[model samples]
Target: MQTSPQAIFFDVNETLLDLQPVKESVAAALGGSKELVPLWFTTLLQYSLVSTVGGRYADFGSIATAALQMVARQQGMEFSEAAAKAAVKPVRSLPPHPEVPAALERLNAAGFLLYTLTNSAADALEDQMTHSGLKGYFAGRLSVDGVQKFKPHRDVYTWAAEQVGADPKDCLLVAAHGWDVAGAGWAGMQTAFIARPGQVTYPLADAPDHTFPDLDRLADALTMR
Candidate 1:
């Protein structure tokens, strides 16, 4: 069993905040059904991995735009820059999922330091967090821009650990993405997987320390730890 951590670093996007609005926006922009949103999201992540492997980096928004265009092209639809921009706009306005606020409050009341680590640009992350009523819960927001790399990268996790002045072993990385948790675990940090539906688990080589269905469960487990 692991000891209670001094700090908890969370992943934004689908982890705490619901992406349904953004998904709906993308569907409307693409003239496709809402089901297509997951397809677009998957494509976006695939490109991020490709860019990382190729030693190239693009901001998350830029990547989202490109991925949208590609998804449009795949559907034999001409991409609309305006629609693409509109599709991504909801990202900055997404609200937290039902369990987020209460879970955050619980963790905060327990005296755990909370922070955010996201692939989003700082400006965008600030807007999203502030609008979601979750702004005050975090000590700071750590964007991938600082490291010029995306999640699953060791440097990004290490950078976050250093930023908050916490030891990797004493910090618990919490994210809905298995890859994010796996990467943090690989970086020597404890990890909790927030198992959002439809997301895949990472390979065993990159598995997280624990998996919970949502933030509430994670908070409860942390308290017990």
Candidate 2:
């Protein structure tokens, strides 16, 4: 098993910030039903991967808007650029999941260097973390924007490790998304899969070094304090 990681890189969005509000906003703007949120989000991820694999670059916010338009048209819903922006604006202001603060505190107290490596742009991630009251617990934050690519792309993980002076094998990625765990595993980083409700690890990927239902349990397992 992979061990002795020198740094921990966290995935933001669903892993930390509660996306329920964003989902509700999406629902209100579209079908007036929250179920559309998952479909829209899945479309967003698909296109993000497409853009990266095709060697095109666009900030995530722009991509989110485009994805919204595509989904709206597919659903025959009215979607203006302004309306799309309004629907997703809540993303910048989401609250951290209930267990996040104390668990991060536990990890920090135990002397692990914690950082966030997100698909968001740097300024956007700053706003989200600051608004969520999670900014101070991390030593730093890295974004795929800096690498001009999205997660599941090997370079993004390698670039994040380089930014912090850690080898891929010496870093651990903690995320709730199966795609993320699979990507990090392929990139040679140890991983902790947070199988939050409705989330599951990728069956085809190598298993995570640790798995937990929530951050609190992960803290209990990893924290020295």
Candidate 3:
């Protein structure tokens, strides 16, 4: 049986916020090669971990721009970092997933303490939550930038838990990315894997405490508890 958690932490990008607009922007910049969007995102995540493990830190926007440039170069296209930044500029104002508002309302009404735990920088997160109209639902907004590490990094997860005054085990991390779920689980947090379209869990990782197709179902489940 699952017990209620002290707080629920959400991953910002692609979990609560939709990424389709950013994907389309990247595709257009890549000469309409929509196929490269996933590659660019994967590269972005890969290098985030690389920087963390390498004991270096760069803001998420800088890493994303660099990843875009790398993907462009692989396709034999010359892209300036400035161009890459422009390509992914839509990230800051991404809209929430369609069901996000109502689901968050339900969760908030149920008295669940909601907070965002994201890899985006503080300013970027503020822009996103405010632009997406999600700012009112959360009690706190946490950024990995504070710890100088990225998601899937144990330190980041633990740091978020500490910020919210919850034990790692008392926090439930909800994320669309497998790496985020795995990292939170390994850090002793309860995990809910939001298997959003095209998202899947890592095969080698421990299974999440809960799996739901979307936030609607997740809200249904959590509220019932």
Candidate 4:
């Protein structure tokens, strides 16, 4: 991101918190196979985009539940709501990625207001951060549920800026997801993409001003003052 952003918005799920446990849980629940996990996640994101473009609204957890069930049916696997909840239970108690804390501290110390913006349900987000001992780092958190639109939609990024009391231009979005960065960049916010292993940016999207393999490096690059 550019120097001195007035506020920084973070994408929560795989960006700050680790989701491997949830993936593992889902994989185990689905006949001890891991292949369906990726498909389910990808489908979840696609369905989220569908809801956003269709102008329909659903909480993230609800959408996730439905998506899981749909995937299970397609795979001819039995997945009850109870089972699905069990599989996804790890989300509430996920640990932060190893590089996250120090990076956040650097940004906080550099005098940037920090906030979380995620597709997760608002209440679930609070629980996730509190459970992971990361609740205090951010000044605030917002959710797609609030606007009934998902990230990569210009409305979400611009609305997030308004919530943080800054123009989109003065806000920088930090995320591991290419689509999130692309959306924020298109919304006129500076964006930095954290290239977590196994993740890639949308190739057709605008190039981010900064790309780091991890948060610690990103912190060093942007907040070295």
Tell me the lDDT of model 2 at 157: 94
59-159 in candidate 2: lDDT tens per residue? 88878888888889988776689999888888899999999999999999889999999998788999999899999999989999899999989999999
Across residues 103-203, which tens digit of lDDT does each residue of candidate 1 receive? 99999988889999999988889899889999999988888988888888898888888988888888888888878888899898998888889876777
Off by over 4 Å in 2: none
**On residues 14-124, what C-alpha lDDT tens digit does candidate 4 reach at each position?**
999999889988888777779899988988899999998888988888777778888889988776887887787788788999989988888788877889999999889
What's the best-to-worst order under TM-score? 3, 2, 4, 1
* Segments in model 4 whose C-alpha atoms lie over 4 Å from true places: none
Model 2 scores worst on lDDT over the 10 consecutive residues at 216-225
Greater lDDT among 2 and 3 belongs to 3
Please give, for residues 126-171, the per-residue lDDT of candidate 3 as tens digits.
9999899999999999999889999999999899999989899999
Given candidate 2, what's the lDDT at residue 200? Answer: 91
Q: lDDT of each structure?
A: 0.86, 0.90, 0.94, 0.87
Reference-based lDDT, residue 9, model 4: 90
| lDDT ranking, best first | 3, 2, 4, 1
Error of 3 at 137 (Å): 0.3
- Top candidate when judged by lDDT against the true structure: 3
Residue pairs in steric clash, candidate 2?
Answer: none
Off by over 4 Å in 3: none
On TM-score, the leading prediction is 3
Backbone-clash count (model 3): 0
